[model samples]
Target chain A: MRFAEAWRVALDALRANRMRSALTMLGVIIGVASVVVLVAIGTGAKREVERQVEGLGSNLLVVVPGRIDIGSAPAVSRLDLADVDAVSRVVGDPSRVAVTVASGETVRAGRRSDFTTVQGVLETTPAVFTRRLGRGSYLTASDVDTSRRVAVLGAAVAGALFGDRDPIGQQVSIAGVRFRVIGVFAPLGQSLGVDRDDEVHIPVTAAHRLYGTQRIDGIAVKAPDRERIDDLGARIVAELTRRHPDTEFSAVTQQQILGVLGDILGVLTGVLAAIAGISLLVGGVGVSNIMLVSVRERTREIGLRKAVGARPRDIGLQFLLEAVLLTSIGGVTGMALGVGAALTADALSPVPAAITWWSLALAFGVSAAVGIVFGVVPAQRAGRLDPVVALRAE
Target chain B: MATPAIEAVDVSRTYQLDGVSVPALRGVTLTVAAGDYVAVIGPSGSGKSTLMHLLGGLDRPTGGRLVLGGREVGSLTPPELATLRNETIGFVFQAFHLLPRTSAVDNVALPLVYRGIGARQRRERAAAVLGRVGLGHRLHHRPNQLSGGEQQRVAIARALVTDPTVLLADEPTGNLDTVNGQAVLALLEELNTESGVALVMVTHDNEVAARARRRITMRDGVVVADSAADDPPADSAAVPDGPAAGGDADPTAGDGTERAEAAR
Candidate 1:
């Protein structure tokens, strides 16, 4: 028999039991939709992390005072201004290196006291990173050399301490010491779960006297180009280790950080998609059960058809086609629902979501496969029935 | 004469029922020629239904040679036999067996679906046959919408739509009232006379059997009498309750010609 004719017969059978068909398809719909929505959320989170990392600087590298490998404990701060100079000599560019030493402290400007992160940084902070000034001027090399008490207020810190008033050149006290605000940093929201706009920046020498710490927290450096980042990292790590001698130091490039984060998110997405697929498997089982019931209910009809002229293969194909149709329709509906949910999630929720074309295709393909895998037994049973005995059935 | 539509030579069918062998047909011989009108009459479990099943190719004989449409029944595969049935035979069962929720024309057009015929031609042929059965006005009616007599006529149309050489009817009017039964029987006789298609019927109604040109009576898996040549035995038709309604006949001792003459 023609495939088209078999399809028509299958469609007719499904139409004869509209409620049962729809209920059977519901399983597959939910399975496919869950896979789509879950995968989109994972992919969206991964992309968001990548955007934040790239925003900092593409060719940037960081050197910290520890052997920053798996299971290694963080060490005491062994990096100081001398280590910064040593890194500058190896980089052959002074403005390409910046160092920061941060601790939480209260700041008071005309009795508006706010407790926030206060970082001791060099004049090269703006040149080494993507941070920008909103008003006034950034610190100069002469300010650090003279141990000048100048501060660059973070967006949030300035808003809290001055309340929208221009704070540049205003006097503020940190740890009982007075300092003049040199600039205000632009507004930057949270990245990697850290609040970027909730801190203060000041010349490195002044913060050493206020916090009474000789060692810096970490050093940031920008390579001349993408290709030389690894080479620059190796040289800086060797130079810093040589200077400290007794302590271990590590230098990491931007690609290494993004790669590790990507692997974790990728696995998470796969796991979620697989969990959703279990529901699809259950849906396929429902289809198989219904087909078996239909065969039993129509035994006399099968015998009649066989008595007239239908072959066993014809009967089997008709039943198999019915099952495939059930799941395929369910799969399509589920995919649409998933995409719609993903879009809705992206618009209304903080949880990021992005639909990948391949996820939709994979979900659809798996649902069809589930139909064929689960449908085989019932179709074969229908085909193997004895016409004589079938005709006797009520 | 032309090749007989079906010829069974000492064919037997033994069924296995839960580790016990139950013989349904034990070495029964029969022949049905082209355009012949034959009726099979017997009590329940007398092998009349078994003989019908074997003759129609819905089953195969366990022993002996049975030829249908010029092909040995034992030699053809299941698919090949199905195709042979489509080309050479049509069946009208007691239950009518019209697909529910489907119109009469489509039910009649089903057999042709296996013949690779286009849908339009199939419906047209089915409509023409329905017209011959006097059911052309009810072409679009479902089985539930038609009376028992009209349903039987629709079934007859379905059997005739393929233009088969032999039409097999198993208790064709068993489910109908007397009036509808007579009407369906009259329609079958008219089709047989006008078209020259061989007609083979299995019925328990002695009056129905009397209307046929020939009759074969079976008992205990064997043919006890055959009026294929002359006439039914004198005693066989006299029992209004039906010959063999007694339901017990010698299973191992019966020759077709001798027993028929002995009864006379």
Candidate 2:
């Protein structure tokens, strides 16, 4: 038989059993939809991590204090202001790096009070951290040199404390000491659940007196050229170890963090996709069962067709086409549903969800393969039927 | 001197039922030429249906050679036999075995489907055949919407759509009432006489059998009588009567004694 005629006949048969066809397609629909939605979420998480890592600035490396092992005992190691200055002197480029001494503190401004993070850094902190002021000017070299009690408020912190009021040049009490707000940072949306716009920035010397802490938490160094980031990171680690003789800190480049995050998210996506594939297997089995039943139900029709002149291969092709039609329709419907779900998730949650064309193509191909693989046995059975016996069947 | 439409020489068929061998046709031999209208008449177990099946290539004989349309039927492969059935012979069953939900046109077009004909050509040919069978106005009506006689006509149309050289029918009017049965018989007679297609019909009813120009009577898987060669009995002389003879024409038309006499 011609393919077009066979297709039309198959479609007619499916339409005759409308409810059964729809029910049979349900399993495949759910399977493909879940696969798409899960992959979208996985991709979304990976993208969010990349964005967060990118937010730190270009060619950036972070040096954080690590635990030191001594005689089989792990001891907490500290990175202080002296170690920061020693590392900077060894690197010999003071303009390319900035150090941050951070602590959580309670701040009060008039009738509003909230706990917020405070970071103490040099006047060049804005350039290194890729931050811009929405209001007043950033801290100047004189402000740091004179031990000035000036602060830069994050966008969220300023909103919380001043609420439509101008925050620049206003005095806010940090750890019970008054500090004048020098600027308000621009709005930077949250990434990975951490709001970047919810902190206050201050000069390093005044932070020491206010919080009574001499230790600097971490230091961020920018490569003079993008290609030198790894070498710069290695030099900082070597210099810090030489200065302290304890190997008490770890220098992590931005690419290292991104690589780790990518590996973890990739595995997560793969695992979710595998789990969703189980449903497709179940759907395939459902298709096989339904096809077997259809063959059994239409035995006399098969006999009639064979008696007229249909070759066994022709009958097999007809059934196979029917199975493929069912699955391809299910695949397309599931794709639409999955894209809608991903879009809905992106709108309702902070994390982004995305559907790629490759996933759609893969899902369609898998569904078609599933139909053919599962449809073979039933089609073969239909093809091998003895016309005499089939005609005799009621 | 074209080849006979069907030739059965000492054809034998056996059935295996629950591990026991039962013979359906015991070395029966017959030949039907093109454009001939032949009917086989017998009781239920006389193997008339089996002989029809063999003629239609629906089953192969266990012994002896059967040829259809100049091809050796027993030697052909399954697909080759299917092609023979499609192009050389057409079948009409007792049940008017039209596909239930399909329209008359599609049901008639079914045979052409296996011939690799496109749908439009198939439909056109099918419509032409249905028109020949006097079903042109009911082309789109499904089988259930048709009367018994009309459905049988559709089946005949399906059988003729491929324009086969022979038509094999097993009890073609067995399921219809008297009026519809006569109508189908009349249509078959017209097809045989006008279209010049060979017709081989299997029927136990003597009146239905007499409608054919020649009759073969069977008993216990063997042809006990053939009316073409020997003169039929006085009561069985109603063969010249038309289908208007209806159901109650003659009571002793195909009695066993007359059949015996006809065989002699």
| Best model number under lDDT | 1
Please give the range of 10 consecutive residues that has the lowest summed lDDT in model 1 chain A: A1-10
C-alpha local distance difference test of each model: 0.86, 0.82
TM-scores of the models, in the given order? 0.88, 0.80
Tens-place lDDT digits, model 2, residues A176-229: 899999899999878657788989899987887777778777888877777877
Model 1, TM vs. native: 0.88
What is the Cα-based lDDT of residue A49 in candidate 1? 92
- lDDT (10s digit) by residue, model 1, range A79-146: 88888889999999999999999989999999899999999999999888899899998889998898
Model 2 agreement with the true structure over B1-264: per-residue lDDT tens digits: 457798889999999899999999998887887777888999999998888888988889989899999988889887888888889888898888789889999999999989999889999999999988788999999999998888999999999999899988888889987666766776776676667788899998897887677889988888888776565453234333332223333212123223324434
What are the candidates' C-alpha RMSDs?
7.3, 6.4
